[model samples]
Target: MNNQIDTLCTESWSCFKAYDIRGRVGEELNEQKAYAIARAYAEVVKPKQVVVGADIRLSSKAMKAAVCRGLVDHGVDVIDLGMSGTEEVYFAVQHWQLDGGIEITASHNPADYNGMKLVGRDARPIGENNGLSDIHKVAVQGHFDNCLPQGEKLTKGCLSEYVSYLVSFINPDNIKPLTIVTNAGNGAAGHAIDAIESQLASLGVPITFIKIHHEADGHFPNGVPNPMLPENRAATTQAVIEHQADFGLAWDGDFDRCFFFDEKGQFIEGYYIVGLLAEAFALRQQGAKVIHDPRLYWNTTDILASSGGQPILAKAGHTYIKQMMREHDAVYGGEMSAHHYFRDFAYCDSGMIPWLLVAELLCVKSMSLSEAVEKRILAYPSSGEINSHIAEPHKVLSKVKAHYSRDAVSIDESDGISIEFEKWRFNLRPSNTEPLVRLNVESRGCQSLMEEKTTELLSFLDR
Candidate 1:
């Protein structure tokens, strides 16, 4: 493959996306580029040791190795966690008491793409405003003096610890007998699922798993493993349909964020899952606050409040949400985009947590996933999430805001613009990574008004 290193990145650095870096592999990222990034990262963080992991992508393993080489050259010790997800690597960083960590995966991007997500000592995000700017400058230079004459390499695996902690959160002993379909999408989550399922089986839980595409096929012949796409999720949905399973589960490339498909072949939003988790956490830590972003639904707010946990809203990004969880000492936090952070796990988000919680919810209660979500679905009907491209982003946002920002209702620009009304509210914000704007509308349990307001807003955009 052509290495894009030792070259000027003139593509507006859009590849350095919102929360982490991702792009087309050859054109945007390659070994040379990864080396510079790793060297730059070593210089900026100056961490004594860095933990590394990657997905099942063919290039991901090499990309991670190159990064380790760069770090070791920079006189930084490397702790290699072979074949793991992003969150599992993050947990290793915390569990190992290392300085920071790097996860070599492109998240849900296509097979041709790959990237990295960096974290500080506490398993925090290194966003653009944070240390990313310094790292970018170092990467641009592609030369570093921190390269040591020689360094040491340590190989360790966090799979067992990660699985132990996840099982600790829920009792596999109490798990109910249920037929479930889990789709790993040929990513790095197979090993993890294997270990966890073994534990479940040992506990005598009758979880009949109809596993789909569980192998680590880097070719991704079945398209990107991102269940967010209707096409990519077809296999999981089909499994649920054919097997008549209780529900379907899906995870991204690194398994940090999970997606679900109900038995009826319907994709469920991450927002509702947040509410369900809030319920679980509340039961454990009564009156503990839950953090949520202002997107799609207020189900989180309602769930936390009814459960006696305070609900605080933050901007919709991993960095912002993580900071909020720390500030408020929240028991849990979630965004509509499927990122869920937990204070119990050192204020880091885990893709494994949601599935474990789902299993526990099933084991403890007699309710199906759909049955549990019925009341909240009726309370806050949303327009899901809509994305639109605009040549003039600022102008369009201002136009939308001008129409509502000055109204009698309260307005917020925390993450985006949320013009609140008694019966309906809408949030419009530009995405940090994509060239499109994100729009969400929800009503106070009013279906007609939601349709009317959504139509009106789209009409405005149409004009």
Candidate 2:
């Protein structure tokens, strides 16, 4: 879009996708770009102080240093949180009362990729609508004209406090008897969860835990920690079956989202998890506001509606939902992508909260993970996200919309394009995280209809 941008360099800036920034490391993302973003970000937010963190990417330390340099050079006091997950940076910004934060990560992207997630004061995301585009424009201009008195970079070791904050949220001792298998995929979550597990034990809850790839090996020898991928999640499910564990869990590279596998080695739909969290949050805060994406479960909507909570449908992305949560003072917001935001926790999405909630659900229900999730599946049968890659994702969406929108009971473009019928609903949205338009469908107590719609939608999406 920047026409006069001759040196508008980097690996295509594909990292600047729909949500946050992400791209391959040496190829597109590097210290120069990181510094550029940091300088521009400080100019926009005009923060007196900012917290910064980085994942375990081999290139992250240098990139983080570059980011800190940019901030400090612009008279922004830098509270370097050091190496941490994306959520930890979010935590430090609010928990430590910093003005804003930036986390260097590519999340589940391959080891060679890295990027930054910029936030405003109180850990709010800086999307294109808010200020990220301006930051990008500044970075592209390549010359920062606004340089104030150089500030200092101070180290803030808040991982201990971060661990404490997460532990305090859940009744660790009261957790139900259960077994959990998780693969951190050699990301920073391994270190954080290991610390939290100790806290859980101190609460007198003896949880049987099995962890695979529980080391900060950014090499990702076991593959990226993104459970959204079938191959990446295969080992996790197998581990659950092998141990007969209550459930299997996995996190992204920086642990911003959590995914689950039932005791039967089945991956539970993220929509149901959103529903379960909504009920839990509503019970604690009566008549609270809850936000949900309209992808897989109308049950989440219906449940929140009946649970004495106000249900609001949000566009399916972190940027939109978090702002809505803060505006409405929502107790919680959830997406089928497993992103969960808490109003009390600075309105930032967390990968850790869901795991703690699931642990509690196991204790309270006296049932295996499969048994607990099976009820929801029966309530709204789903067609798991199926993706098809073509030259043009929009062309495919347009074609699918032509067929489904004619008799549509409801139509939505919240995430992608969603068209609803009397008894079924399906959405075909291009993946910001990938190169395909994902198709997810659910039917109201009609397995056959669910299948029929799923087949038809996939057939169309595939083209």
Candidate 3:
């Protein structure tokens, strides 16, 4: 290995994770490293043109500039989308027919963190198994051949087109006139929400939007925009109750994953939302196939079966979900972590489309958001994902498997160890992003049983 590559590997290989590149801004990831990675990516993918976008992180601009420079130096034409969400890069690549795309974003990570997500033609992901590893190898080498003619760079705005496409997912005339609360949590979501609201007004849709933390502040004055945390959801939940809104919505830093709230100020789990959206899409296109992650299963599978739709289980991750959706030509795919993928959207996950579909579902069904998902929740009670930071995750998984093997009616390890019994099932998998083990348990119409299994599993993992 080259001395530079040796240095990077020894010092800060933490930036290169399983699915995407992420790390602390200046310490682990910097402009020079960003440039090296982009050059390596260009060398590996050899794309004629690439779309580049950045989030509102303070370091994103410089990082994006370095990446663009590297791509341009390699004779790859660059279409810069300026500050944008991760999905915008996906949209731009497919919409503009670019050869590849890159988004400089760390999603819901702290303000001090930043990263990059890459996609090939058709917005196909380049994760660890495919091109990311190659990029890492080439990046560490840090050597690039000279190009006689450097590539050209052009800047463009994609917000309007993206917003129009988002609104096209649902019929504006059929949507009910309801007040909805939206919290951007001071992330990049504010821009898209504002644009969508403007487009809705122009189309004369009588929807009222209540906004909070609607500014793009990198300091994260409100908190990181991850609604998965109970504390971070209080603002959106409270706003829904105070404004008497039909429902509430929030998005992470890059606006790729969105979370939902009910009319009664209750936060909805992403697992149930998967079922709800699956049913919605199935109602529109009968016999449509829906893809879901392996972490939580019963609710989504049951809903798909009842809706006359095919349900496919994919290993959990954006790259795997998108690849499976394309392979099966599935209409929609969702993960419990709020990543919702659509066939219509280049098989890319969007934080914007889920809430739009939910709103339209409420309007057409004449049911409140709570009422829409209550049946599914009661039918399959889940102990939302519980994470524990343990030193020996693999050993713990092996122990858990050994303990449950005999009792489990069926066992599988597509993504992790998933054991199923007569009435309940649980999945214990090591997290890809963090040093932790994530546990997800669900029961058949038994909340108490779900709780019991969750407690038991926690005890086993903790011990």
Q: State which candidate, 2 or 3, has the greater lDDT.
A: 3
TM-score of 1: 0.94
Compare the candidates by lDDT and give the number of the best one.
3
User: Candidate 1, which segments miss by more than 4 Å at Cα?
Assistant: 1-12, 406-408
Q: Which tens-of-lDDT digit does each residue in 1-463 have in candidate 1?
A: 1234435444334467767888788888888778878989998998988899888888998999999998999888999988889888789888988899999998788788899999989788898888988898778766567426656789988777888888887777777778888888888878888998887787786888888899988998777888766678778888999999988889988898988777776778888888888888887777888888877547777787778888888888888889889999988998888888888788988887887788778668878888877678788877777777877777877888888766537777777677888778998888876677888888888888888888888888766
lDDT of each: 0.82, 0.83, 0.91
What number of clashing residue pairs does each candidate have, in the order they appear? 1, 3, 0
Q: Give the clashing pairs for model 1.
A: 73-148
lDDT of 1 at 208: 88
Highest-TM-score candidate: 3
- TM-scores for all candidates: the values are 0.94, 0.94, 0.97
Better of 2 and 3 by TM-score: 3
Q: In model 3, which runs have C-alpha deviations exceeding 4 angstroms?
A: 1-10
Model 2: residues with Cα > 4 Å off, grouped in runs: 1-12
